[model samples]
Target: MNAEIIGVGSELLLGQIANTNAQYLSKQLAEIGINVYYHTVVGDNATRLKETIHTAQKRADLIIFTGGLGPTKDDLTKETISAVLDKPLVTDEEALQSIESYFKKVNRVMTPNNKKQALVMSGSTILHNNYGMAPGMAIKVSGIEYLLFPGPPKELYPMFENYAKDYLLSKLEIKERIESRVLRFFGIGESQLETEIEDLLEKQSNPTIAPLAGDGEVTLRLTAKHADSKQAKKLIDDVETEILQKVGPYFYGYNQTSLPEELMKHLINEEKTIASAESLTGGLFSERLTSISGAGAVLKGSIVCYHNDVKQHTLGVLNETLNNHGAISVQCAKEMAEQIRIKCCSDIGISFTGVAGPKVQEGKEVGTVFVGIAIEGKETVVHHLQLSGSRQAIRQRSVYYGCHYLLKQLKERD
Candidate 1:
């Protein structure tokens, strides 16, 4: 089914808030073989919303709406939809009870306007809102399906996942399974990755190849649809194998597996401990590593040597090295990594010393980076980089490169 996601909020048009609901819904719909043709954003005006709905109904079989479901008077999504569909707004008993129970549980006073959240379109299926007060609804009018959701992402995400997805699935006649696999890659440009798999991307049929580049990384989302689940997976695997054959060296991990997470996975699997000496990144590398669980088994500690004195006094980097090569030099980075590994008694040590943008340091231009890796019983190595961007961008990219370098070293060991 072709669908249109309508976001109802003047805040969205005024740039007060983002319409992330459309992005989430579009991805969800695609997984179910439903194509999202349009994303419409209309302010809280009933007349304009009615016009938008008319326009959507002309082109789409499904119209999903998000926002304007609150206690405020401006929250008129349901009222406008009910008017357009000629359906009366009726209070759902279960929804009303749920709203009341939520207020009671919080020991808060419920205003009269709050009851409006429990109202649903007449003859519509009630979708429970576990995260918020507003109960969403799914109603069919003139053969077009309308799905409503609350404004907050926390409310909309779970409501759609737990209730709306199953409801839509039940309405489908033939249930065709769609499988999607996202291959994450780093140290490769989107154009280069696409060129490697250009043939498959051009003549793609069963499993489609879609390349997206963002923040020094690229991802290829492969989606395959079939009646049988295993057959669909086989189709996806076949395409994946062909793509991997050409540009697999840059491939790091699968869907939703971040660089930090992938690095941690390898460290944990190999039973290796790590420590970090951060300079320009300012402990960001350590923060990324410690953010994921099971990091304790592999992470020993981190030393944020932002100041020259800290590098020399705390991590025991020689004052001679700092004065000679400077703190941003590859030599200093290598020494930092080796010293941290020795001090923390870890199997691996990583270091980040960089000149993030805005000013040149130590006669070095901005975006000059040095990432060093020191592994036990292995030669210490440093990767020199001349990057470009704002200070934050350079720092973030430095952290990503550090993770990628560590992953490469771990993979080499394996």
Candidate 2:
């Protein structure tokens, strides 16, 4: 089914709040073989929303709305949609009881206006919102289906995943289901990667290949439509295998798996431990590594050797090398990685030393980065990167590259 998403809130228009609901819903709908054609953001104006609804119905088979389901005067999404569909807003007793019980449990009084949140569309499938009081609704009017969800991402995400997706899938009359896989890559530009896979994309038919570039990385989304998911998956896997045959060296992970996540998994699988020595990145590698749960299993510790003195004293870098290399060379990176591994007594050590700046440092131009990795039985390896961005962006990208470097080496040894 071709669908359009409408985000209804003045706050979204004013940039006070982001419309993350559309992103999540689009991904879910795509997985279910629905094609999202348009993303519409409308303020809480009845006339404008009605116009949007009319436009969406004209172009799409399904319309999904997020936001404006709260207990407030400005929440006009349901009011407008009900008017457009000529449907009544009836109180869902189950939702009302849940809201009332929540207020009672918290020892707070429920104002009459709060009941507005429990009012669901008449003759619609009510979506249970276990995470919040607002009930989502799905109804059809004049052959165009509407799925109304709450604005809060926490409430909207689960409601749609558990209830709305199944409801739509059951009603959708399609001969095939679309299956997609996202293959992530590092150390390869989108243009170069696309050039390598140009032939596959040129002759693509049953499965299509699309490339996206973001944050100094590349991603290829492979999508296929087939009657059997198992057969569709095989086709997708075969296509992926063919692509990998050409560019697998740059491939890092799959959908929703990032450099940090994959490194954590490998570390856990290898029963290895790691530590970080930071200079330009200033503990960003450590912070990201520790953010993953069970990271303590693989993460030993880290040292933020930002200053020359800290690098000399904490990470045991030679003063002479710093005086010559200025802490931005491959030699310095290797020493930092080796020192951190020895000091922390871990199986692996990683280091990020760079000049992330608006101006050059120590005769070294900005965006000069060196990521070092030291494994127990392998020689220390240092990878050089010349990146360009803000200081924070450079640091974040350096961290990803650091993980990518380590993962690459680990894969080589494996």
> After best superposition, candidate 1 residue 378: deviation in angstroms?
1.2
Candidate 2 Cα lDDT to native: 0.91
In model 2, the runs with Cα more than 4 Å from the true position are: 88-107, 118-122, 128-131, 161-163
Residue 222 displacement (Å), model 1: 0.8
Query: Each model's TM-score?
Result: 0.91, 0.90
Worst 10 residues of 2 by lDDT: 169-178
Clashing pairs in 2: none
Error of 2 at 51 (Å): 1.6
Q: How many angstroms is residue 121 displaced in model 1 relative to the true structure, after the best TM-score fit? A: 2.7
Residues 32-77 of candidate 2: C-alpha lDDT, one tens digit per residue: 7888999999998999999999999899989999999999999989
lDDT of 1 by residue, 23-67 (tens): 999888877778789999999998899999999999999999999
